[model samples]
Target: MSYDRVRAVDEDVADALTGERERQNDTLAMIASENHVSEAVLEAQGSELTNKYAEGYPGERYYGGCEYADDVEELAIERAKELWGAEHVNVQPHSGSSANMGVYFSVLEPGDKILSLDLTHGGHLSHGHSVNFAGKLYDVTHYEVDPETGRLDYEALARQAEEVEPDMIVSGFSAYPRTVDWEAIQEAADAVGAYHMADIAHITGLVAAGEHPSPVGVADFVTGSTHKTIRAGRGGIIMCDEEHADAVDTAVFPGAQGGPLMHNVAGKAVGFGEALDPEFKEYAAQVVTNAEVLGETLEEHGFSLVSGGTDTHLVLADLRESHPDVTGGEAEEALEEVGIVLNGNTVPGETRSAFNPSGIRAGTPALTTRGFEEAEMREVGDLIARVIDNLGDEEVYAEVAADVQELCDDHPLYE
Candidate 1:
């Protein structure tokens, strides 16, 4: 990961590249949306396929010299179909946000009603936030989790849907720690005569590996990011029934983007092929187990978890109940100073601003990817609690940083 070849030409760019690689190798990556892809995936993404400008789909092209590109894209689409059990798959969207836009372009009109989860309540910016394109183009309504329980109240969602009939309903979340009821959300969308789109961006790998319930057959549209839990290249994918295939393909290509990222599609093909192996399922299972251990340990340290705990690979802890004096930003900084990396997130019924909120979201996907187990997670949790308990104590931070360094040394990354 030195980027020696890059250094031969542009030393400045190579320095930054090496710096990033070293940063990943040294620190813990607890961000729920982040994960380390395989070296094979990395090679596939940095291939000669990047030179090709494939403007169209397989068996049909807008330019000449697309034979190899067709082979790569076709394999990607077929493997994605197998992994997700979708009748059709589109692997050309540039990112998860792009995939969402494709579905909206296919079925929704300007001023159409969109019902999605609230951003501060474990939702993504692409799910109709005011700053995003979806919010500006569509009439948006939001649903929130139960403030007391910190879990989704599907009955409340159903009542809201009935009151404000929408064109589409978006499920899936960014920082949520529990399993979703795709069938239940489908029922609400069905009762309201709206399409259901589940953005499994964070759990793509888990669902593909059978660690989580799949929304492929239940929801009208399923979108995911290939790079998250899927451990692939950075890109987006859309899955739907054959009835909506053409609409999705057209919307993705001529509608939202021009040329597809063929190299990333190749990487997706390779990564999805690896996921079909039995080992990937075991890895996915360990991710959830490690998260459970992490949440349990944090709870033992007097931290309050959203939804009580996690059934997935992430944990959301509301600092307001546990560390009333320390904000999420302060906790994040203290942890980062000790080489423990995660993010400050807004909790359900949040009273703080989005920039620096009252909650911290952590995950086990990357840690499990680095071969960490439940015991290692418990040790890590103890270190996190120590830092939180002594936020301004320099001696505690120094000791924790040394311990974190030892952990990083034991479980080396990208070696």
Candidate 2:
């Protein structure tokens, strides 16, 4: 992992890279959108493929020296097809948001209506946030989770869809911690003569392992990020039926982006191959089990979890009831001081602003990737509660940091 060659050319950038690697190894990564990739996948991402420009799909590139690129991409597409069972797949979008953009360009017209979850309620910026291009280009409407239950009320959403009559209904989320009923959402879209684009960016790995229900056959189009729960390198993927194949391909290449990140496609190929192993399914199942343990442990410490608990790999703890004076940002800072890294996020029916919301969101993907299980997560949850409960106490911070360091040593990442 030494960046010796980089150090010879530029010392500052090399130091930062070394520091980041050390940091990951030493701390807990609880961010739900993050995961640790295998060294095989990392090598592929940093491969010579990045230097080559494969401007088109496999076997149909605009440039020469694409033989290897074609091989990597074809392998990636084939493995992805086997993983998700999509009729057509595109592995070229640079990110999950770009994957959504590819679908929008392929099927949606400017000013066409888009119905999606509210951003503060667990949706993404690409799903028509006002600051994002999707919002400016389309007419956007949003649905929220039930304030009392802290879960999606599909019946209310269906009514909202009928009233709006959007051209496309976008399902999937970034923060909500429950199983999405893709069929139910699809039925609403069908009732309004609209298409469904399920962006399963957060749950790609779960769906691949059959731990979570897939949206591939249910939604008209499905999108995901390769890096999140999936051990793939950073990139995006789109899956659709054969009917929309050509349109998606054209939209991805000449429409939203220019050249394919061939390096990432190679990484995806490698990671997808690893995920096909039987052990990956066990890993996925443990991820959910670990989250359950984490949420239960937090609840025992008097923290209130949104939806009462979770069905996914993450849990959202609303601090409004348990620690009224401690904002999510304060808890986040205190946790980080003790080497536990997670994000403060908006809760449903938030009373605070987004910048410093009323809740903390933590996940088990990176920990599970590091081989952590129920016991370790329960310990980690206790440490988090201690740090939040004693925010300004130096003694408590030091004790928690020591406990966190011992756990990190036991799990040992990137070794």
Candidate 3:
């Protein structure tokens, strides 16, 4: 983790890197999609495999000197399969979006209809939001969570599927706090003869650890980010049955991406190997418990939780009710000033702009990774409530920052 070599060559970049590490060491990273990887994963990602140009799969590379690259990729693929019980796993996609793109290219033609959860209701941009390439290429429609329950209504979704008759139906979410019923979505997809793609970008580790129901067998395709709930470095993965393995591989290789980031693949390998350990299950379970504790504490402070509470590592608080005058952006700013970091997220039935939405999404994955348990999470929640309750109080901000530093000190990372 030292920057000595970089400092000898480029002092400015080294300083920036050192500063970032310090900042992480100092703050509580509560971002729903972020986690601190182990030093093993970090070292693998920073390894010399970055220079490789293996253009094809293991044992079938187009270039020479790819033995190491092939070994790394194969290990990553095998570990991922073991972690997710996937019939076929592709660790080559550069990002979660890239994995989704590979799946899209493998089957659907341009303008094919896609049915997914609405973006404001916890869907990702790659699920066919107009701003993304998927949106531009595909004909996209959306389903919404029940406004009253703040959860998906399977019957309604089925009705919608029957009405739209989309070529594909995407399950899973970004800010949702409840466990998904993969079978229900699959039944809908089956009725309509549509492909079901479950995007577990936010809960890969939970699914792998059996803390959440997996979509591997029920859904036609599964895609996820390696760096989220999983303590892997930055990467994406795609899983499908053996029937679509060739199509998926071909799409990922020459159709969607050229050369894979082999260093990241190595990181994925190490992270996946770590996840296979029995202790990782305990870690994943703690992540959910911490999230539940955080959500319960926030609720006791009058914050409105989307879906009422969490079954995974994150909680989506709709600030529109409890703090009507305060926007998510304002709360985000104040929280960051106190060294607690998360995101301003859009909630269902959003009435505000996307940038400054009506909700704040807090997660415990990173904090749990830092060795925080229920008690620490509860105190963190109280600190967040204090900040949002007194946004402009400088004295209060200083007090909360001091407490955050104490927590960071107690649960040291990268030591």
Off by over 4 Å in 1: none
Per-model lDDT: 0.94, 0.95, 0.95
Q: Which pairs of residues have clashing backbones in candidate 2? A: none
Candidate 2 positional error at 6, Å:
0.6
* Model 2: ten consecutive residues of lowest lDDT: 406-415
Give the backbone clash total of model 1: 0
Off by over 4 Å in 2: none
How well does candidate 1 match the true structure in TM-score terms?
A: 0.99
What is the lDDT ranking, best to worst?
3, 2, 1
Worst 10 residues of 1 by lDDT: 225-234
C-alpha TM-score for every candidate: 0.99, 0.99, 0.99
* Poorest 10 consecutive residues by lDDT, candidate 3: 70-79
Give a tens-digit lDDT track for model 2, residues 1-415. Answer: 9999999999999999999999999999999999999999999999999899989888898999999999999999999999999999999999999999999999999999999999889899999999999999999999999999999999999999999999999999999899999999999999999999999999999999998999999999999999888999889999999999999999998999999999999999999999999999999999999999999999999999999998888999999999999999999998998899999999998899889999999989999999999889889999999999898999999999999999999988887
Give the per-residue lDDT of model 3 (tens digit) for 53-100: 899999999999999898888899899999999999999999999999
Score residue 210 of candidate 1 by CA lDDT. 89
For candidate 1, write residues 1-415 as lDDT tens digits: 6688999999999999998988898999998889999999999999999999999899888989999999999999888888889999999999999999999999999999999999988998899999999999999999999988888899999999999999999999998888999999999999999999999999999999888999999999999999888787899999999999999999998999999999999999999998888899999999999999999999999999999999898999999988998888999999999999999999998899899899999999999999999889999999999999999999999999999999999999988
